[model samples]
Target: MTETHEIGMVYLAASDLELADAADDVRGLPVVTQLGHRLGEVEDLIIDPVERRARLLSVVSGGILGLGVTERLVPVEAITRVDDRVHVDRPEPAGDGDGRHRGDPADLAEEGYQPELVDRPPFAEVYERYGVMPFWTAGYVVPYFLRR
Candidate 1:
């Protein structure tokens, strides 16, 4: 039986292996599958206020994004275990047929980093209409938000 109610985010593992002893964790782990893989696993967790738990909303699925991969929504409860590998049961998106949920815009806007979005094209238009000012540096226009 599990003891801790509040999750201990960090854990331990034993090491020391020979050259042939191991492959890359993602490539070798059975926890990774075609429909989804651990690489696409979330690095940072997001807490949904309504749901009230830390969920695996997105994963760092090893393609190439700032946090190392894309942001997707996964359910926190779907986790069966987390150990030598991360495991999950992927979720179906909400009724709109997009991965997005129906909610207050204020909630989502509160959830993400908008300074970058403010500087871009369509995003810029949206933000400007909403009166959001994009980040600027030396008066140059960046395609996306970049830190100064």
Candidate 2:
């Protein structure tokens, strides 16, 4: 039996996660410059309808903060899991490619998600009204989104 989704809820699993912080050292990662740079933060992890698994919605990041904070809407299928770390499958930069990105990051359902749900800001007004962030605690997993 499937669980019913809440009126305004986006769901993801616990296993599919990679946490990076400002203090962490990005040794092998490339620099912030370059157009086709595949680095972005893990802004969101929504369920993938096709793979039925937790996926990385956002990755390292587009650019510096306070401008747009552009996020990559990667599908769950591309996420790779190993011991103590989660990895995202970013496409290699192709020479002489068009200006467009490798894939459509908008491959998520808009129904249950609002920008206020995640820490990635720009919904300051709306999130402020709530007075609480969506997932605050360490084990903030929603059971409805999990399939065992």
Candidate 3:
């Protein structure tokens, strides 16, 4: 099987999901840039099952009739502000051509993910392939700031 499929399997293999149907929390929230560039809408939030916090912001952009819909995963740190709209900073230059930010795998090591898991093959590759940051890679403070 292709590595991409294997990576997806890893995600599926996760038995302990943080929030059952996390998308409900942030669905319909407009995500924009500091300049008010309508990046997209918050399709879902990938939460760390262990941390009970969001690890990635899944943004959906440029899709019609479910034809060309694309999901971009942004690191929680990229979020500069959140209120009526979920505001995020511009992605770094290292992003993929699709305008999605590519999170650094090294941060995973610092985030205290199990060494065995981080060191294993395909974890980092999977994360890089999807351009998402592992939730364990950073501290999440957005949930507290939001008006629950």
Best lDDT among the predictions, by candidate number: 3
**Candidate closer to the true structure by lDDT (higher is better), 1 or 2:** 2
**lDDT tens per residue, model 1, 1-148:** 1111223111001112122212212222333332454435443333322322332233334332232223333333344445566465433333322122223345335654321111112323322332323322255342211111
Which of the numbered candidates is closest to the native, going by highest TM-score? 3
Q: How do the candidates rank by TM-score, highest first?
A: 3, 2, 1
**For residues 35-66, what per-residue lDDT tens digits would candidate 2 score against the true structure?**
33445455444433343444224333443333
Candidate 3 lDDT tens digits, 12-124: 12334444444326657988877888878876554454444555555767754444554565555566677779876654324444233323355333543321222233334
Model 3 TM: 0.53
The candidates, ranked best first by lDDT, are 3, 2, 1
Worst ten-residue run, lDDT, model 2? Answer: 96-105
Q: RMSD per prediction, one decimal?
A: 19.8, 15.5, 11.3
